[model samples]
Target chain A: MLLFFLRVINYKKNNYYYNKIEGTIIFLSNFAPMIEDKNTPKTSLSELGEFGLIEHLTKNFEINQKSTVRGIGDDAAVLDFRDEKCIVTTDLLVEGVHFDLAYMPLKHLGYKAVMVNLSDVYAMNATASQITISIAVSNRFPLEAIEELYEGIYAAAKLYNIDVVGGDTTSSTKGLLISVTAIGHANEHVIVYRDGAKENDLLVVSGDLGAAYLGLQVLNRENEVFKVNPNAQPDLGPYSYLVERQLKPEARKDIKELLAELEVLPTSMIDISDGLSSEVMHLCTQSNVGVNLYEEKIPIDPVVISTCEEFNLNSTTVALNGGEDYELLFTIKQEDFPKIKANPNLTVIGHMLDKKSGMALVTRANERIQLKAQGWNPIKE
Target chain B: MLLFFLRVINYKKNNYYYNKIEGTIIFLSNFAPMIEDKNTPKTSLSELGEFGLIEHLTKNFEINQKSTVRGIGDDAAVLDFRDEKCIVTTDLLVEGVHFDLAYMPLKHLGYKAVMVNLSDVYAMNATASQITISIAVSNRFPLEAIEELYEGIYAAAKLYNIDVVGGDTTSSTKGLLISVTAIGHANEHVIVYRDGAKENDLLVVSGDLGAAYLGLQVLNRENEVFKVNPNAQPDLGPYSYLVERQLKPEARKDIKELLAELEVLPTSMIDISDGLSSEVMHLCTQSNVGVNLYEEKIPIDPVVISTCEEFNLNSTTVALNGGEDYELLFTIKQEDFPKIKANPNLTVIGHMLDKKSGMALVTRANERIQLKAQGWNPIKE
Candidate 1:
């Protein structure tokens, strides 16, 4: 079934076989161009070489985080996070398995790649300060294509106040791949882990769920429509929110600061990358607790409900199983609930339970369905 | 021309295409097996799932570093270096681009991958502490195959006394790729950078050069021989050192301590990753100092010299242009020369000169030849 989406678009004798797996791509390349526009000049990557490519691409990056003692030019990046405990996390994005470049713009892809890793750092409740981006690209990618990718990466670093410490850039055999490692720091007492939730802790989530997944749905449908007719320009006004969520997922860097201002330290925390249910299961399994998640309490955007109806997808299921939201999911103490209750950015979704009670979602009609982690493990399928 | 090395082995109706790019692959998978070994049981990776595969692979990886506050099973790994500064380095090894499984073993590839990154950390004059490994594998890799790869990773971690802190595992469309992020720490005063060398400093290098490159040549030659004659068991006793250097190169972790013991701090340092010439040019460019490298002073193992003679290649050229030596090259004040003069492990190959003097290789015959960086950039070729 996955093979059905693999389409090849040959341009200038360059064959790009788009392998669309269930992945939100970070394609920061400008490979996609307007048809019949031969004015888009292309320079071969061979002209720049590896070192020249690295220097040219990274010359514009500025170090904002003081923790980064040295970046780029050295064999390794030197970081001084002071006395604060350091948090490190990494994620790899493969072209065929994690992205569909047919519809996904390369610039958004680069921004999303950095955004995904920062989300993990914020999930640790630490202040993300530095990142290393290593990418493997095929020779088909010109120097200009990589420049577009780096532009997005530089923009993300500048806006998020993170430093691009160091990275490796090499050629891949067939396709493009990106590996990003994010480093953050925080005081020992303020740090949070997934294994700390108490039985009665209230489950809280920032922002709505399922929009990113819906955005992917919209993108796939549009891409299909385009493949059928190149000139077709379907209005995407209604699906803009979902499409934006899918393409340019901003990490919840503010959620950590917002929680601090509210004076509510979550007992445990995780990022909503692989849908709500999967993240909830991770917290419960790691914390040795159960949760009573209210399906109605799931904070989803109005557009998500309306779009889900249009696509014949159950909105609750989408929230529970639609991955790549990039929102923070955590459990706060009941007393701290009063502090976060009136916040528009926060939503109280459920309450933690004893291990034996198990994880279940309470339906609007009061029906109880056992929760299961439906993480999109494409390798398994 | 690269297409000449690509070969496919069809077994069990599965097509295993070997893309032999000029890279040392960290395969760490038992994908290549002894012919007619049908008894070798194989379990599909899908059976383990993403989380299960991670848990199973890392179950044996015991955290050895004190800096690792938390390893695996979290959103991010927590590390505390206390007053010491943190050093981070990352490298991505892609199959086809980096290594040819036709000759490289999975275990050695895994160890070599970690070794390659650790070399960068040691070049910074820091203590290698922790590492995060992120890998993407195709469905072709079975559970047992990846287990072999991890065994090598675990072997390297255990031997080097580093912690396997965190990582992400996902599927790739084809082949296997491993990205290793090494984190280390050192006191502020002791940390070194590549831009600190001054004119009149003595240029030095640890161990010999060109052996790793010769090792690859031997392997590639042997692989071609094997393709023609499967039953032939050619003797490799003479090239053991070269083969070992290529397959299991060790990072110079003890150099920093040794230098400290001798009270000889390097003015600037870099690792021999892109050959001696490229690295020297970088030091000169960054530190604003030129170097007069003596050709006769180059320390080459007898095996490398013999192999170079057999291959009709110039030993000096190989030492200068052949890379992946994993040796640390640095410069020290002229006053520190006496301290290291008696040490057999360290070799003084040249002297730093003023920027106007320019980078040159003073040949054994007394001819001064201008030096140029001949980094093996496969992308350009």
Candidate 2:
């Protein structure tokens, strides 16, 4: 019976024909097979009750954030964000809708989920200090799977100078769903809002765009190829930059520090999540301003350009409408432009206009086009 | 075509045949049918973009919390929870596993979702001030359905004096899932924890128990009957109290203020989400004490006892094993008992013992039984 159990566990791991039974796997845009590395042993989540599961998963997480009065192992996390203004953001990532586990590893998914919430925190120019993660998983997942997920969360928590304060664990009926809430703080004077931009503020963005979205496209393409030919191991060396951006996005935790060092504060800020156009419009609309977004000045990674060309796609459009680039987009005073002009990480993509001027995208051909919030809408898709 | 759409939607609302297609619906324990009232007009979620949906749903929410600097329509909600200690708790509720919409109204589900998080906040003897709700729903739901959900959430927030701070709206591949993060604040001196109980402290609980669990059973039973006979309108008159306890459970928000009025500080506090025995065990284990829970002293609603008899189940067993009773359980110094003795809402269940004695239930027949934490485990079930 012990030998039989071993064989069954091992067989469960390497079930090549698991796709037939994984019909419920929900990936956005396509149906992807649920696949995982099959070398490890499995422990059903049933072995541990909810409290025990939370305790086990969170035992390794060290509570180092000074603002965190108490971390896990309590009914609620206690935080002391004295004097500074507190900011909160939350997002729910349903399996298949917000994430596709077929291509996204459990660990990466965990890390990315944290990154997603932290991005919003940083968008407020706040120092992210604490986060609470709650997840619901079906019994199909083993204890090891959740452990891996928490490991990623711990990794993010450690690197980001944040504490995992509190969370909940429960069973889902279908697949895995993760909800992450990030809490951050900023001195009232330094905090930026999307409604602060004045006319003629310099529109700037950190890092690059289009890479994360293209990375997803590459992953999906590779996934499809593997679906058709399971033996194929396509080279991913060239698309590493894009794939990394998609699978393991790092929220711009350093941007606030960088701006502080330069003695420049943003007039208005928003994160580039639902594509550049969508976020840009939100910023300008809220600021009671418009923007002239220069197509030629929009930052795009070299790999994104080459990958777009290879896929017969437009890099400009990808940069405009492809979301999931966890980069900060903000407007600085024109006087501060000189301070950030030489910075390699910053790009002046556009300048703000008066609200009556209406938002527009300045094409490379010098044609003006109105901004549309046609970002990725899961419902529409 | 318009008529066809209406027919489809109206049929969808009262979907008798919908059960066959809803095999993926994941309710905890037994399978429950997907049922809904049929009079409302349906608007596809696809009609509104994600941001638009959030804006529309939150349009009516008034930002009444003084700490709220900025509510929705931003990357994050800004607050000013200064000198007071801030508390945060979160929970993820998945469709089917955590709820069955067949008997649970969308509005009630939304209200209960908020209450679940608030219960944890109040457990700390804090004032729940803000909440961020993130939900992922499939296209199978209409915009009106989501609106109904938000209405319930709005009602809860209004009554609880909480500001709907920030959240994310996204599409799910399967059924609906909601994640709520509640933020509360308290003076450091007044905040209660789960590790402060003394050996001689009096163990107490607010309100009654077992009704919520019995309510679920009643709903599931009625669901089965409705499945067998589409026209069987369940006359829930007798089970009204149980049904209300199950469906629209009010978190013990008043208990904290009431305790203050009574001038009794609970040494250790925990909310009873699970059964009485399970929570009692948790309180004891965390506090490093043992408990002598008098079975007869355990508060049970008269209706709950009658319903248990009707279902041919032991009331004590149900009170010990049945979960989802959102009552406040705490321990206070023996000197505080007289202050709370005459309170109708509060009941002294038992007393704490030394850790060496272990936890036990003293039955009416004078038999001592070790407390078993056999509360609901969705994964195991």
Candidate 3:
């Protein structure tokens, strides 16, 4: 099935590659062109080195967070949290394993890295305030490449309204590695953890799922087709949403605000980074409860379903086990479900059960099957 | 000169390699051997995978910090800083670039990773309360090896009285990469910055310098010898201090406490990760002051001096340009110099001057020479 898509893409490449590329160029010309200096001399990283590269990339970032006492150029960035409790989380992204630079733009990579860490902050019912990004890159990456990467990072920081604080830049032996530490602050009373879920709690999720995974599949297939035929200009309009979800997924930052406005506090919460099934297991184990996940209620997009059919994979399976959704998954009291029932962004997918009941998925046929955590595991070959 | 030392080491190896190893074995037998379960079943990382591995490694880490409210098994670690200001700093350490596993024990690597980041927190005159350590390793590493690495990390967390908050562990494309983020807290009134120095401030450094560099040289030489002949047992007793300085370097955690005890606040402060000259330049540029550094007053351990002489290198040059001392370098008012004069651990080697004057070193020959930041530049080929 994947080979058929590749063949179709290759056929389209031979027939309409140039015209499609021209259309894309015309489309992109509407926006401000990204600054790419072809005439500028390529500076060897050794000339500016680690400290200089850091100073150049981070020089423009202003400390916007009132809690931020100091930003870059210090041993440590200082923040005054006052009476608010602080939340901290870190994520490490390595090339070849976590991302393929061939199709992944450096800018998007930077934005996604920050988003992934910030998603965890939001999952805790906290507002992210600051992040420190430490990157190690090989000599293969020119200073301009690093600048482009930081531009994405700066854009994410601005969009999220967070401060770019202190970080270390060093030389790597091979490939680019980025580690982001996000700091957030929340009131002690509102902070949530995964161990607070109770029986009869309604399992709710924000936004749709499985699009990111299918998007990755589409990109992978397109990349394979391109490898075979370099002139391939695969029509990506149909897969644009999925591709965007894969390359530039956003954290459900507004969900916390919405929940606050609705006066519904989650008993237990986690972000869907490793698929809904895996995250459900984590929540259930931590909260010492079982879950009854309804497969029909799993919010998957129509595009994802079509793509999954084209790939000969089950949409339900993809939605259950596909990772990197970055959506909020939490359990609220059954009585609180009414507050979120009218909201289109959120869906009640399941409900918590007693520990003796065990975690199971109720299918459309009304048959129950045990759930397993087959989420994306990069450790496997 | 290096060849002569290698020849001497080879000659010693030819004569007493086995006997020396036997003696070393006897010496090690006196202490508890590190836990190594080579005979046990080897489990591929794929068996437990990422999440399981994280849970297995971090399960035993008890939260010791009062600031930490929620740790591990959560979207993000939560900390209650109350009214205190929080300090954050992050560092990236790549395998071949920052460390070599041949000589660097994984435990020491873990401990050193924590120390390096905590050093920055101390440089800010704050008390470190928590840290998030993210590591990426290639498949070549076994589950046991990762356990050993975390053992060192757990040891450091215990010794420092800090909580292990949260971090990500992922698979790297090639070598190991560790990024650590240290979070600290300090009263708003006592925090220091690098831009606060004024004219006539006394420049002081904690402990001696260049020992870490010399230690690296020793390790590199020993590694080269081992590569040529694995059985060779080079006598390291004479260079033990240097080797320790490199392998198990400690952050000057006591400096902040000592300064508090003496009631002297640093006008400007920075850590000597990059050699003294580079850090001095940072202070001068940030603080808008020049400095007159007395070469004769620069502290050097007797072992470091002898090692430099043996290597046919200038002790003053080594002290000035060598990096990774992890020592605090700061300036204090001239009036406060008397308070630290009797402290053996602190050495006042320079005094701040007006911006009109240039940064210079007064040599032993009574000649003044402009200082250069010829520190360790790993980016250079």
Candidate 4:
């Protein structure tokens, strides 16, 4: 049943090249994406390290909220409550399920833990002011290791300028688990939820996509190469932007501010942590509308294009279904579009459609195609 | 190292009983004292099932705040910000490390999760009003399992009249993890911290102690029996109260209200989740004062006595070191103690001493022994 859904989405790409040895049969078909090639091997979490991964993951996130005092750059995220409107959101990250410590560092794990929660608060169009982090670890983690996790937490808190007010810490017999509850405040009118889009609204994205997905590919390929030859060092040349997107992605706090400065309010909004298609589908479904996205208008970073071509993958498909972008995907009225178009960072991707039209992608050739979401379905994999 | 601490606490007792007809060997220990054994053993969480477990776990939790217009028994906890002071607290629970799920039910787990945090807020002489829960789980669990966990959560919310404002959910590679953050409110003047105790302050406790720990021991014994012989039914005759204390515990919300009604303010306070000794020590250490606990004055339920006799454990030691009673341990001025003592439910077990004298336990024989914390240490076995 899970496979049927995957096939229906048609987002899965089977064959891909590893950027490593220019030419080498590293491995064959499996659900996992290729991260590296033959010459460049994968590195352990301890080697590539925490900061490196964070830098790799969050480079392209566009800030969307003026109230987001701090985004992924801090310890606890900082948010300026508008009119004392309380910000509320929840996040759940499973071990082995969401992360593989074999390739991820504990400190980064802790850092990412805070980032994910902050992302949700930002999605609500509210500045993340305070967060309560909860973690359950198995006996495998030592006291010192737990302390290391907290160090990252404290660091993030310091960076974000949010209080580490309270959280629950318990033991689990199985694996490590973390859950964070983030709270922020905003004006009752300024806060955006998922249910406000209307027909003819312009769809806008804060930043480019597919870089994080590609980064994961690079890491996986490198991992395969290292398994074949442990002595080989990873040569992650020229793909730093893509690589960073996967390890430490950021939440867009700036674009949110820009929109406010322009006096433009999003009709509806959600962060693209899953995939563009999935997030767009969410906006449409929640708002009881449809959408038409122009393929030509979708922004693709040059690095993503080059990498896609090198790997024999369609850059469009990568942008459409690739996950972990953490960019803001929002819609605004037509009148607001002109005001935002002047901003170099904002991209008008498409427009909301009437419910009867359903959701579709309009190619540069003017050919219309149905837009289906192939989200990051970890369970299916 | 862990064993050294356990031995020092000296609460350990082992008993071997041979049931001729059943041809079974049973090992028992006495740890908690407040609960009725028979009532507790019959309704193990497993027997009641997950949803049943939650209902059973939160049956006794009381709400004391007007702002907490709602609590543990809801889809999302609700709160009314009716000009009341707000206070918040959170705690985390880990598997294997913090609890042996072997004897702990999912419902009880949920109940305990909320109680622990609520207890913290109660310690501050605050009324708990809202809570946010976060959970991380491994794929080893089915969606139904997660629902079961939430069932327990909802049960607690409803029971306590706390609104479930927000939380996070994610997957874990290893074990099940739950983190609960509770928000409470109280008049500014009424809020109590651990450092408020003064010399000659009377130490008082709400309700009896030690049953939860003893309840854990009974469950462990039954589990051992079932593990050895899958076909054998658990022989939990006449130990219900103790088992319930271990499985489904309640927070002391009532005491907060009662204190307010009597017009008595506690000088210092903390909840007894980490055993009376540890809490007492905390009050002394934080307040820079000494304490002398009269052992004979400590309250013990009748069931605790019979269980202690049956298990060959000293009831006093069990009451001292057993944890998770969810009762409030607090200090009041000498004048206020008379007001509190007039209430039958309150027990004045000890009084604050000078800092130079340190913490001590006054035995019935009039001998004073230095007190040390030998409570449940999750880090140690």
Candidate 5:
């Protein structure tokens, strides 16, 4: 079992053909895929608890920047900031909008609230430092429950070394709302923007994708089973990787530091809160470039593969469209590829193309297929 | 009217108080007459539009410190942090809770949002410098409305001379929500905390109070009229003072600088956001002291008094309990009292007492009445 675990972990690190997934495994866009077949019953947000949903959502993110200092693991992320420039970002999470509290534990909700803001600061290639959290909660929440929420906040703060400076506590008319602002500092020269990737730059990602989405699928299935028979225990066996990815997603602060250490400045970068396909499109559209990804290069975990097969879903589709992978999708110059190739955590999936070439995918059969983005659009459907 | 206008303009410079109805007058709290009935129909917030409400709320705010280079008037408040210390504060405003969009204009909402955050920074006796804003809105809002909101934001930013450095935009499931974080700096030596007031220190305020609350009442009344008969023009003529108080409130950043130039360092300071009475209570409780506020010295604007009379409410009660004045409530040593006494804008309202004495009010009829806080409590109603 130890050897098997090691092999599974090192599988992507070694160059080996694991399966015959059809879609291109390369530089896809950042949006998550939507399996819009009427046969698959649509689920309402209330069906999955907040924790289960967040776990389902963030399964495939990989942190790629070292300045990310601390990622999804803290109350507020910590960044080295090297010297000079400091940046902070925050967002408000309102119930019925950001998440449904019915399925989300107050603790995980607090944790995820902080993570969402910290993700933005990380996207700037800066390290997060301090945060102020404001919460408006209805009287429905007991003092003990509020304490549980703070426990999660305090735990993440300790893990990230962020100071909980000050915030307002007010009564809300409806459900719970959380707003967190995170601050960080970095050397002005080192900060990366979304508009820096160039044609021919190698597109790379850290770690495997699509597990979080599959994890959500498994949880959803289990939730349905329990609904039918309350006595039925959830069979989450073999879905540990996906479940963990969903529950406590970590930001890619380490990857930021590794890139700096390797002296590889990514031309452009963004965190994969959305799926790989959506994020890739963001990079492409922002940089005014196209990309060509090879399906053979996409990383897929063994558990994800087995789970996808069990669920009768395409592993390639899951990897391509799965969201919340917090992994870094960045482009490095072709000349730096030799140095980056040695990093076990780094995966070179595709290359940037001219805008006219458009975004395409190379299947396992070596046939080129055009790639289109179908991310989660709350407004459209 | 010309003479009155000139006097008002000059009051800005000489700090003189003219008793003219439309000009400038410092409503001394110590001179207010005591009322027999305490149960005056308290004003309701729902009556006022957001802008009118903010204007009414900040009318009497006084700037007392020199380092407070800029107070409530900008995108982010400005302060001279070069020589002193600085502190930053922020808060989030959510629709359906913090405000109702049914009556709020995007422009005023944007301006008021920045002002609210700057108030906290001023409460710390620091001047604001920079601000970052993050907003989440549902699709129900149009692009033009968003632009209007930005116009208000940029207008405040430009007026305050603070750059709109960064912010985040995302979709919300509910109405609009704005979160503003402001940064300010002050001299470390001159920095004042809420807990620094000493026994017998002189209490001072910059301007009058209760107008904002009254303005809220007026707007709410008008709103009700509009709701029933959309064609009914808002009968706001008599309550213009209150309306302005609520619609376009300004921070007293200028007063902070004047205090520095005049060489007065307040022993303790806090913004009268909750109301003069509540703020005094906060300072006294935090400092482990009591206060003796002379009713006659509390500044009550003639418009506020007339409006209060029209509404059958005592001017004294309105001045004492009305909230959102954003005026600085501060205490100074006996020695500084003489310097401020001659100044037109500053009014000595009361003095600190030992903790054993507790907080009390000295009525105009020489009666001792205990002061109680009846400021805005959103949760109660």
Candidate 6:
């Protein structure tokens, strides 16, 4: 079991899979599967209770945000941010709608939940300091299961150096639901909104897009195959990057740092959670500027391209409409281009045009077409 | 129909019932049944879309918090609190777990949700300034139904002088889930924690107790009756105060103000949420002290007492263990008692003792008994 666990780490540092039948964390290996026996005990949540469960999970986390005066144990967390304005954003994710537990690991679910909120904070060029996670889970889950969830939450919180403040934990009537509120601070001079883009401002995106969406497709396919044949092993070696992007996608915490180091401030910014096209449209609509996005310049990872081909889907379309990338899309002044020109992660996809240009995308074939926001609406799905 | 709507207000200011079958909000009238006709139009959520639905719901909310710089319509809300420390708290409410839609009004649910968070902030002797609401609803809800929900949210926000900042609206996999995050500000000197209580400190409570819990009992009983007969009209006339306490319970926002006016700062404070007994235990455990609460002094509303008798429950027991009162419970210096002695809403119920003394209650009959926290655990319920 130890050797198999080490082998699983060789696949991904955080790739531990949950064995539903045995109700334990394990890893798949070529030699033998790592599964705890069914006789292993599962601690009921009622045994620890709500407050005890919260304390048990959050005890390992230390408050490090300078603004965070108190966390976790108080009726309300306290903070003092006198130097900058505080930015707050919240997101709610419901099971079956925002995620499918069948393919999504609990730890990855926790990490992704935090990333969703932090990405919004970074979009405003703010340094995220604190987050409160509110979860409603049914009795179907054990205390150990919630521990797995919070382990992921702590992993993300530590990675981003944000404090885990106070939140409420309640029983849900049905499936799991997660709500996260991210608090950040930003100086008035450095703050950015979606309405600041000017005509001719260069549109730039950090990192490649669409891999997370394709990764979801791969997981869904594997899930279907597993449902059909429980004994079949999923060989996810080739789609590691894509799968990681989907599972443990990182927020653009470094992008703000890089921009500061390079002395470049974005005129307008938004994160690419609802895909590039929707985010671009939001910037355009808010900033009163149109955009000319070249199809060839839209960043696409090699894995995403190959997977798109394998799935018989258009890679460019996938990049345009595939959601949950958690990448930053911002418009910077043309004069600032020189500072970011050599950066491997930064890609200039387009330039903002006058509003009368009507939000068009100039294709590589020299044809112009209007852009539409095909945002991920799980309600419809 | 218009006359019935007007009558609903005469019955109670926000007396509106949800028709589960039609998935619409209708005013309840004692004279006539509120069943919707089959010909009534039901607007699909797809018609307004997500963005349109949000805009329609939040357009009426105005930013009133001086600290709030930007609200709604942005990636994140911005707040500036330069002079004081910031306080943050969050709560999650799930349908069937926290409330039953059969009896609870959406607007009341919204108002109660905000009260839950604001109560926490006030417990720290902080002034709440801003709130963010995130909700996940199923397709069964129509645009108008959500409007009623937001109507209640805005009503609470307006009454409390809190700014409605940023929030997320999404589709739920099952029932409705609402999450609220409240932010407040306080001077470091004024801020109090649960661990600040000391031996001989006077323990005081604001307003009356047991009414909210009794109100829930009234609602639940009426719901059972209504379930058996859809046309049954719950007179609810005599139990108005109890019902209101459960539906639109006010947070003790004025407790901080009252304390300041009386020139008596609490050494330790906590909100009475999960029953007075549980909250008292929390304070004692955190402060490493014991408490002697006098049952004779425990504030119980006459209506609650009468209702407890009607339901065959002990009024004193309800006062100790009934939750959702949203009242302020705190410890103040014994010398400061003279300042609040004349205040009708304030009751000096007990005094703190050394940790070795343990927690005890002195009954009206002069009998001393140990106190136990029978907190409401909806998970078990």
Q: What's the DockQ for every one of the candidates?
A: 0.67, 0.63, 0.68, 0.21, 0.13, 0.67
Candidate 4, residues A1-381, lDDT tens digits: the string is: 010000001121112111121111222223222232344343332332233334333343334545444344321132343335555566667766777654444565677777777776677676675666666655555444555566666656655655655454555666666777666655557777777999999999977889888977876777777678755556555766675566556566666677788999888888887789988988898798989999999888899999998888988888999988888889999998789887766889999989989999998889999998876754344
Q: Report, for every candidate in turn, its global Cα lDDT versus the true structure.
A: 0.84, 0.83, 0.83, 0.67, 0.64, 0.83
**What TM-score does chain B get in every candidate?**
0.91, 0.90, 0.90, 0.79, 0.77, 0.90
Better of 1 and 2 by TM-score: 1
TM-score on alpha carbons, each prediction: 0.92, 0.91, 0.91, 0.77, 0.74, 0.92
Candidate 6 local Cα displacement, residue A21, angstroms: 23
lDDT of 1 by residue, B162-243 (tens): 9999998999988889999999999989988999999999999998899889988987787666567654544666776677
Q: Name every residue pair that clashes in candidate 6.
A: none
- Residues A314-360, candidate 1, lDDT per residue (tens digit)? 99999999999989999999999789988878899999999999999
Model 1, residue A51: C-alpha shift (Å): 0.8
lDDT (C-alpha) at residue A69 in model 4? 41
- Candidate 2 has an interface RMSD (Å) of 1.2
**Model 5's DockQ score:** 0.13
Error of 1 at A178 (Å): 0.6
Q: Give me the runs in candidate 3 sitting further than 4 Å from their true place.
A: A1-41, B1-41
Model 3 chain A worst lDDT window (10 residues): A18-27
Give TM-score, chain B, model 6. Answer: 0.90
> Which candidate should be chosen as best, given TM-score against the real structure?
6
Candidate 2 CAPRI level? medium
